[model samples]
Target: MTMQASEKTPRQKRGIAKTVAFVVILMTVFVAGFFYKILQPRVMNAVELRANGAIVFDNPRIIEAFELSDHRGEAFTLENFKGKWSLVFFGFTHCPDICPITLAKLAQVYPKLESDIAKQTQVIMVSVDPARDTQEKLAAYVPYFHQDFIGVSGDFLQTMQLTQNLNVAFRKVVQGDDYTVDHSGNIVVINPNGHYHAFIKPPFELARLLTVYQSMVQSF
Candidate 1:
């Protein structure tokens, strides 16, 4: 009987320890879940921003001074990007598919934006094929989609200055003595401070783009 009681006491201590461990683990999960619920709105907002193609940067990149000419022959410099938000696309007039489609979708999206946002925002298309896409060509091409949309182009070096800083990639491809400019289709967003803020990935959906853009501007 003495031996049996000693064994039972050990078993009881083991049982108590197991209960204490289970209680600690259960409380840890419960505390974690309570904090998660409290933070859900901010967490979900960030997730929704990414899901909608609004890839915001943790730190905005500063844009250096670069010189290019706008469709109106005005000096389009880094200063042009200040004082308002700019949506910039890199493509050429000869882009047979993506450029035109993206510009058309932007045209549709622009007018539907809230009045305050539309007033403060500007749309710009920078030519990747400066050798073939002249100011006259851009002037005629860019405004066809939207009158307010600005087209920018310059010498190869000047174009490179902006494209390199923005991380926009482009190259000239030759086919049968003619050439085409292959370029990225992502739309770059510049904040009012002339800093690189975010980018929207291509195959852009009009509704999603509008929603995401509005959310970014409002949040800023």
Candidate 2:
């Protein structure tokens, strides 16, 4: 009886050890899954941004100080870009199709932003054709799309200063008896630090734009 009891005692101890090990593994898996569930949305946002044609810079570019005038005739400098997010588009009021369409799309997206984001965001139209896009012209045009939209224009050299640094290209093409300005259609995103963070390309979709903008802002 003593020999049988000794063998049973050893078997019971081994069974309890196995059960403890299993419990520990189960607890570990549960903790891991809990954390993953919490982190999954952020990971998916980055993926969605890429899928939506947003080009996020690994290292954001610094914007140099350039003086310009807003539609309200206020001085708009690098400081104006500070402390808030700026969505900048380079176009003229005279643009036949692209400018109006793009601005309308932005207008549609602006009101849909979360209140926090809307408060921190500003939509700006920087005139690529400064010769014809005086402050008054911009004032009348930009606000037609959204009441809060800002129109910016300055001397050609000053405009070039901002555009070249931001990698925006614009040129005048002489048509019969007139000229048209051809410019890049991408929307430039400036971070709260007044740095060039990313650009969202053309063929913009309202949902995709909202997603990309929100993801970038929230991640920042």
Candidate 3:
């Protein structure tokens, strides 16, 4: 009996040691993942194309220049809005969800941008649905968000050329007589030089957006 008890004692100790080691490993793994999540800055989700590094500023591929007419049938070239800031957004007024949300956010951020910079920051919304979004429709829909927001529309070919150059992807989808569009949700910043500057993805936080915009424009 004494020999048997002595043997069992070491076996019990070994079992307990293994359990403790396994638990320690699990805890270490859990801790490492938690810290990695928390320590990482700028969580990007459900947003449009986000430019990394210098693409956001200092340097960007300037997709060739083009000319189009505004909602009021006013002719405009890239040279027109120079020497001022412009926030270019591509989406149509017919869009039921993301387009309105994004434009509304821009409306909110617009005043802040004006107050801080005092430069003429034009908000231009280029409609992907030019077939439906006419100049009259544009004039009516655009100003509803912000009076200063400008609406641009052109022939399908002209709009397509501009969109292709800017790298904005859009498609029309129809279901049960209802038509919808899936479009890129990138809100791009154009510098005074009319160059492709930075882009803001969706799910934008007001504060972070403000900070990023301030940093972006100041660098120009």
* TM-score sort, best first: 2, 1, 3
Best by TM-score: 2
Give lDDT: candidate 3, residue 140.
95
Prediction-by-prediction clash tally: 0, 0, 1
Candidate 1 ranges beyond 4 A from true positions? 1-44
Model 2 agreement with the true structure over 1-220: per-residue lDDT tens digits? 3656456687788997899999999999999999988854342265667778898888999999999999999999999999999999999999999999999999999998888999999999999999999888999999999999999999999999999999999999999999999899999999999999999998989977887888899888
RMSD of each: 12.1, 6.9, 13.4
- Residue by residue across 100-210, what tens digits does model 3's lDDT show? 888898888877763646456788999889889988999999999999888998878888888887778998898788788888888777777777777776676676676
How well does candidate 3 score on lDDT at residue 73? 85
Name the TM-score of candidate 2. 0.80
Residue pairs with clashing backbones, model 2 = none
Best candidate according to lDDT: 2
Candidates in order, TM-scores: namely 0.79, 0.80, 0.71
Model 2 clash tally, residue pairs = 0
Kindly indicate the candidate among 1 and 2 with the higher lDDT: 2
Candidate 1 residue 48 C-alpha distance from true site, Å: 1.2
